[model samples]
Target: MAHRMTPPSRLLASVGLAAALAFGATACGDTSSDGPNGAADITIVTGFYPAQFLADSLLGDSGTNVDVVNLTPPGAEPHHLELTPDDVIRLAEADLVITLDGFQHAVDEAIEEARPAAVIDLAPAADLTTKAGSDGLDYHFWLDTTRYGRVASTLAERLTELIPAEADAIAANLATLLTTLDAVDTAYRDGLAACEQELIVTGHTAFGYLAQRYGLVERGIAGLEPEDEPSANALADLATLVNDNGVTTIFFETLTSPDIAKTLAAETGANTNVLDPIEGVSNDSRGGDYVAIMNSNLEALRAGLRCG
Candidate 1:
């Protein structure tokens, strides 16, 4: 299940073609006019679901008109998302494009080629942490509530800058979202502090931020890519670690196949459960939106770790 890595030359050529297609599409379907409400024309393009959720929450029911579009489809793995011609056209027309850098290479390239009016990259604002033993930054900052709160506040300020007329509403929504984020942070702290075990075994390294936040150790069978398959030695070592740590659960994600997790669980005599990475929402998700899915993840952690 390894992802096909696009070489630098091919990627550049693809970006060039996408830009040309985008320009042609824009020429035919140009609609940059403002809405009839006299509201500023604000079009938000997000790379994935988490960014989409944050942008939507920040612009909650405001009188100022805003159109937020998420490029990644529901239930799709976003790491290697290929941009469609229409998606490139949308990016080219965006007033503001929001993305987490390094999470989706296609979106990063599209934004570079499209050159939208404004771009808000959450990676730098979130002060993201890097995975241990890996030079790559952990792009999953939303897994840590405190870091995500910072990102949310930064997003609010950016939105205010973009649409000054809706500053008050954006500030109010920011306050509410911040409060909820704080509560989530507190819950993770309080719930995980008393856990009997602090070891988390997952199918991939998506939970590095979460494990770091909660002071737990994460043993990932694969790296950042969810579709990657672990080698035989890696699986054997993970099985041994699970038994040594007395781990009772092996965690899988919603967007990936559970077969590997089940196989590891069988080898280790442990049960398996879904510990979503919140990459995208799907019909299989325990709950909708970021908060609900995060709460569900907390519950899974508590149960898997035997928290008091």
Candidate 2:
């Protein structure tokens, strides 16, 4: 069984928000008529699209006051983006701040110092995430549907607690969201189950959790981060695996350059295609909702893996 890590509530008091209901207060606001901002809420900060999209789906149109803003601009790599002094100010007053840790060291520091009302640190294993190379825990947890479900439940419970009056609405929304995600999860299982191959070759090790959940092998051309290149031995092993297993597709991520995946595919006589790590959305994608993105992922896996 995978061990689940829960955030320590007391750790959030540094940001001047009550730890008991920080998520509801910061992200959804307090629903009490006497509560500051009268509970019809807004969201000010988020590190990526998946969490924000989940939050909006949970909050729904009834919570129109809720706003989701991407702290990292479109096409910007989260690991390397620097938050300016102005960005700090914007986050300070934010109701909710969702972020992946370590990669955005600057943002992590700001959160530790600023302590926005409710902060959702997406990197459960922040201590394990590394810039050293691709061999560490990748912070892209939403790529795995199972982990995404856990995260969504935590978000929903917190949002429900914060806005008790809207609990029914939030629960309804969350149920719908979970149902949609479950369908996608089922699709991945059913589709990948009949694949001609079980190995997933990719540019970065972003699909580690996905592979784990689905019982497939993930071979990356580079490390956890896109910028890191594979060792010559790693390349040789990948080539051997492709030839031996008859792996067809070399999957490159949407967020980074695919020069390496393409080259590997060329050398191995395998086809190359795009698989979304979904750190952020590009202009070409319709929008970065978790369902849409994951559906796209399903299609890619079907085509790339020759799913039956």
By lDDT, who's the top model here?
1
Tens-place lDDT digits, model 1, residues 161-219: 99999999999999999899999889989989999999998877888988987899998
Q: State in Å the error of residue 267, model 1.
A: 0.7
Question: Candidate 1: misplaced stretches above 4 Å?
Answer: 1-40
Alpha-carbon local distance difference test for all models: 0.82, 0.71
How does model 2 score by TM-score? 0.79
Q: Model 2: per-residue lDDT, tens digit, 205-260? A: 77888887787888778777777788788888888888888988999877778887
> Residue pairs in steric clash, candidate 1?
none
TM-score, every prediction: 0.88, 0.79
- Specify the highest-TM-score model's number: 1
